[model samples]
Target chain A: MTTVTQEAGAPFGAAPPPADGAGESAIVTEGLTKRFRGGQVAVNALDLAVPRGSVFGFLGPNGSGKTTTIRMLLGLVTPTAGTHSVLGLPATQALPRVGALVEGPAFYPYLSGTANLLRFDAADPTAPRTTARRRVAEALERVGLSAAAGKRYRNYSLGMRQRLAIAAALLGPRELLILDEPTNGLDPQGTREVRALVKEIAADGTTVFVSSHLLAEVEQMCTHAAIMRTGTLVAQGTIASLSGGLATRVRIETPDTADAARVLGTFGLADVRSEAGQVTAELGGHAPERINAALVEEGVAVRGLAVLRPSLEDVFVGLTGEGFDVDG
Target chain B: MSTVDTSTSPGAGSGVRAGEARRTPGLVPVAETLETTERHARPETPTPPVPSARERWAFWRLLGSELGLTFRRPRNLAMLAVIACVPVIIGVTLRIVGGQGGMGGIIADVAGNSLMLTFFALSFLVLLMMPVAVTVVAGDSVAGEAGAGTLRYLLAAPAGRTRLLLVKYLNAAIYAYAVTAVVALSALLTGLVLFPAGPVTLLSGTTITMAEGLLRILIAVGYVGAGMAALAAIGLALSTFTEVSIGAIAGTIVLVIVCQVLRAIPELDSITPYLLPTWFTNFDAVLRAPVDFGALREGLVAFGAYIALFGSIAWARFSGKDITS
Candidate 1:
């Protein structure tokens, strides 16, 4: 549960780059840019390299181009400029092995889930009838929605609808699954289920690219992450690596909080707070053991000592100068 | 994370766990959860696989699917049924009014001139009914999907917007053709069933048999279908502009009416053939004894031009559209 935000000036300390191979990256982009008719750039110079079989989390604030990037990656919205590839296939050439549920689950309201899947199955030349049916059933079951398989999409709850969207993405056994805010409307339990599902899928070797504002979930589920602000990628790396350079807080509870604070201040720990026999201070390059030793020498009766590691939110704010909505 | 041992119960394995075991490891858990909650997974009972895209788009399959969706709706079905009974209703009313005299003769006289009759019957349809039909079908082609937030899913399926638009247009055309045929057939049957079934004097002082009259009616129906194609194209173009089906429908209807009014001006009479509604009544020349194909030919060119123009606009709009919202 250690969380640390690596500062930009800090040396690069990411996992060793994946071995170069022949298979296409799940999603690759170079100089990707999108500008509206008015010349307002939505996504600017996005050069992303999502390795195959990794759960890549795209983090951004509202209108920060996360959805725009996802749209371009899926070819739903053509990029204003640049190139992208999904499932090792050039996005412009053809997108056969890519399945995405961008924005929301959109299905024919009048058609039953089975009918909708059937229509989609019929739309793809590679999916045979028997295989499509089996896949549809399998997908339905995977989203914990077999019981509501026959229900009209109009009648489905928001969470159920989100699940259906995921189920649709699951169809055809796609090589890459791109989901944007997949757990948008899900309750806590539902969110956990989806998080676990994403992890399982990634573990199984399918490149899963997801975008969300849920920092906690991203911290838990993503092996690699990209953070965006004002239509630019400000940070990209593993969670642990991103958090490594953030300030660490040490909270100490002692018989005499005032004395502990005074002792820490003498050591140049100017930012110290003492309340109710407890003291907390920012520890700069100092270990908990060092602080404990100092307190013991000062005859301070320490009852408890804990280090508070920076979470993803803190790291994100540090990099972007703005905090993302955790609930999003 | 809780070690409650929930897996021991018979139903414990009935949800995501049971389903996940069968799928590829990458997608197992998702498949499992969906299977366990089948009730919420989809809106229909799972069925056997469907034909591939190529097979589904095979001529007959596309046609059948298009026809099924068109006529399945009660409104469309009723329109067809009403059109079929038009001739019978006209005949019955004529008979009740006694022999061809007074009000009956007036009705007969109007119906006697096949061109005038075609115009009279379709004026109501073109002014409102046909627009409504075009709106009902083409307006919703893309806009409805967008409104329902399904456009993203459809696009993600990698469905080319061109193909989707083509399918929707073709579907609307089929319904339009069916509607036209029903109306024409009903008029012919009613005219035969009610009026004197024999050679009739034409406005041009030529004579024609009932068989010729029926042929003329068919031609009129074809013209109406062509006119509807323009309406469908307009609808499609509007559909691409906005996600509001009602807006597309209303906009197309108003545009059609405006075009019709413009075509009526004496100064613009030469350009009338290019207008969808103007050519709609050009079915008149078909009633001549020797068959006057001049207006019909011009009307065809006009219809084709309208289709090309409006169809191109729709294609361009949809191709560049950002459907992510």
Candidate 2:
């Protein structure tokens, strides 16, 4: 079952599979946990697995421990319990194979972007100058900020700074790329550019473990996702599978809204509402096509019949019970 | 499909081998197949690069970066310029005042008069000006990153806290040394250009040759450097406690000023040489004939102790700090 799930359709990109099974799993954690001084758990008993070459989106509300999880993966913060591995090596032992940009990408503001890359290259002994420069140039071009390479970071706009951070992540030729809120301050166009770059990288056989609060971005980019609330993983699965189990909403524009609601009420679907000559019902465990046929045969004038598939946000709300102010 | 061999290649199969080997000769395929099988049998993975001794020297790299930042500013250059002009101004004033008193006599007078002037000028520098410069260079070394929200990024790079603090301290030391060198060189050149190059009379009524006087001046500069180093370390130690650079600068200057005021009392004069700023005027004693190496030696030891004491505190605090805040 695990092997079948791992071999599912490659959503981002397809490269040759790991020849020696080296890339079978880029990141794996078992019962990982962290707690602050006040005994408040920031990350709790997380059991996660990210297959090689997959774009895994870690989604959570603000303060839901996404950053904490990324930090632990990068070995910046030690876990309170359990163990994790990256690129087939233990997380504590695989520092070089992992490249990350956690929080805002902090760099020496006085240094040019090229100079900053040089410093990171210097820090990584395995990364030779020639290779690092080639990677840096390629990454800058990939992010569409090659023109600003010579400029100091202090003069860079927020989006440009974010790109520089991404460029830093790409410097190590790392097997797994971890980014925390990489698109935090970007405009829509900038967000799209980063989204495209992430897809491009993942397609090239690098595992990208991204933690973000943007549900829409996660839905568009991630094939596999995990949702966390207050430090606990509430749901984890493939997007298709998670969405498939959610109840689909059905909206009917009927001449007799009251009569339609009365008929739909017999099906025991929860929270049926009526307004403006329209009846909307949350149908549970029933196909939208079957529900529509039933509504029409009941003699209701169906002016409009539309099925609302549950979005990632709806699944998150349904699982957590509390509606998240997603925009906030 | 020819039965797919699910074997790992020896030496982690060449990145392009799997794609390129398809068209290769028969023997090559046999050998490649064997190599792939060997690679899959090994369970232990390759180890990543660990932070070796050489990599740990990022502390020095950080120090160099800090120095670059310090001199990059035009205001720092202006401060250096002011320090360099002090001796020239004193020489010119003495030359103008003692006309026809013979250039040799004017040189002697200027040398004597300049001591008080140097003391007053350097007092302001030591108590407030120099500390401000040291603070500006060292105080922001780590805390500034925290303020700008760059600390986590730097720390996340796994930069060790001890290495970071050491780099900051070294940068502060460089600023102190440079500031002292400028003041000392300016004083020497101004005295040489404005006053006649000859023997200088000391307060002890003994005359010393120009070479001897210059030698004594060099020793005085060393004392200045040591004194400033102590101030820089103290400022750096204070820097680790706060993210605001201005507060560190202000705190250091305030501490120096309070020490200076307290040391000025006649009763406190006995213990003043033990204080960091007390030795700022130790150069005056060096100017006396039969040079008083006693105070200079005491001042050097006192300054060294301060450096070790304050530097260790900075290192200890930073190494264990919970930098996420």
Best by TM-score: 1
**Lowest lDDT 10-mer window, candidate 2 chain A?**
A1-10
Rate residue B8 of model 2 by lDDT: 33
Give per-residue CA lDDT, model 2, range A79-117, as digits (tens): 888888776655644554567888877777877888776
Model 1's CAPRI class is incorrect
Candidate 2 collision pairs: B8-B36, B9-B36
Please identify model 2 stretches exceeding 4 Å from their true place. Answer: A1-52, A68-97, A105-112, A115-136, A152-154, A248-253, A256-300, B1-40, B43-60, B87-91, B94-124, B200-209, B267-274, B283-294
Given the true complex, what DockQ would model 2 score?
0.10
Those runs of model 1 whose alpha carbons end farther than 4 Å from true positions after fitting are A1-24, A92-94, A247-249, A255-299, B1-100, B103-106, B109-128, B188-213
lDDT of 1 by residue, A35-128 (tens): 9888989999998888777888898877889998988886677789888766544563234356787876777676677767666655543444
Looking at every candidate separately, what fraction of the true A–B Cα contacts under 8 Å does it contain?
Answer: 0.30, 0.08
Tell me, what's the RMSD of every candidate? 14.4, 8.3
lDDT of each: 0.71, 0.71
For model 2, what is the error of residue A273's alpha carbon versus the real structure, in angstroms, after optimal superposition?
8.6
